[model samples]
Target: MALSVGDATLAALAGVAIRRKPARSGAVHRTGAPVLRDSVEAGTFEEAFFAVPAKGETDRLLHVARKTLDAARRLRRDARLGAKILTTSERVIARLTGSAVRVYEEILTLARLNRGRVFPSYDYLADATGLGRATIGRALAILEAIGFLVRQRRFNRVAGQGPGPRYEQTSNAYRPLLPERVLSYLPRWLRPAPLPEDEVQRYADREADTRYMLKSLSCRELAEATVSGSLGKILAKLGAAVDRREREAQIDPQPLTDSYNKAQTVLA
Candidate 1:
């Protein structure tokens, strides 16, 4: 987390020269504008776009961070980066190994403070992540393949010619590509998040199980419940109506002999 000149390589430590003081953790005082969390009432979200009480500078900066984190979360979830890398998999593998992603984010954390630039050498990455040189190399490769990171080359300096170094090679430069910004390279239409065949079948099975659960739990009274509070009364009335309708039905095929004789005598 701190800078060590002797240990780092020129290519990877490009973003390390700058340092920012941590945000002071204390009670924030309210100032100019009210946040939306403070204003949400029953009526409408459109009218009252109030925000949470940002008491001080700390809270305000935190508010900004929360917004950024939320945006990053959305971009991460909806992105089909795994599928993009493994073309044969074609399905969105939302949950992949985080080793590479973690490294990518560590670079982003530095880049965010450094104004969208990160050039950590593999050594710095290894030191920060506690991973081996080869592992870090693989992680960086994966990140580049998935379009979450990019790099630039800086001209190596010759000691005699211009700068302090004796002989210089091109040092690596890096940029962390955010999810939302990735659309520039990987279009939305091209990045379709599909489910694998097995996953799709499992989801279908789950749906069927849920439907059965609902059917087993369902009742005629509940179905007949038209209003909210008076369900019992409604059910009682429905039961009575059903009984009466059954009594009114005349299903007999023939009249009794006594009734027939009475009818004949009355006609006579």
Candidate 2:
């Protein structure tokens, strides 16, 4: 499936631009650092510590998140707009220093390892990225501000007896997001291909029929009569086809070679 971007208001965009400044020198990269392992220690997170979404949904979101960051890296390489004023989304991309990227990459690695269930604590992130907790926090804030990800705060429920505190904070559940404004930075070939004219018209007709059905049919009638035979079969087949395509997309994802030229040639 193609990536979906979240809507951003103009005011929100302006706020993002005003709040952040680019990082100057990149942080030190630790060489030969010990590989981070999950532990039962205070800082290490357990599976119960998180409230993650379904794997398939998270996987799709993660793919978009990766592409968005890739676009940011590409922009930094091509433009080299150092110290110049930038738009909201551009600034968000520009501010991703080496340290921030490292932190993000480590998070991605962990997410992949856990099969898209990501809820790493600050301690884990810092240890993995070889940066301090403060640096990890800042990087996460920036990533959140850019609409590249979301953090859901989770809390531990109190044990059997009544205690002083009902719930205590645990590791935040992280999910990736894609903001609409940053879509321009994505490579042309990576963008979703437009539907052919016939397919577009078919969908338009289906939408019109749907609207008519909503207006004309009662809820029970619609559920029982309208949803039988050809219409139901078509809907079921459509859903199955989408699921199949998504599975196929997961296998291939992005081809290195640009197929846009070939597509244009065929069209011509």
For all predicted structures, in order, the TM-scores are: 0.32, 0.44
- Error (Å) of candidate 1 at residue 174 is 0.9
Residues 49-142, candidate 1: write the lDDT tens digits. Answer: 2222223422222233334434344445555454223322221222223566667666766655655445677888888998888988777776
lDDT of 1: 0.49
Question: Compared with the true structure, what per-residue lDDT tens digits does model 2 show for residues 95-177?
Answer: 65566656666666666667657888999898887899999999898777776666665455445444343333467777555
lDDT, residue 142, model 2: 75
Query: All candidates' lDDT scores?
Result: 0.49, 0.61
Report the error of model 1 at residue 10, Å: 33
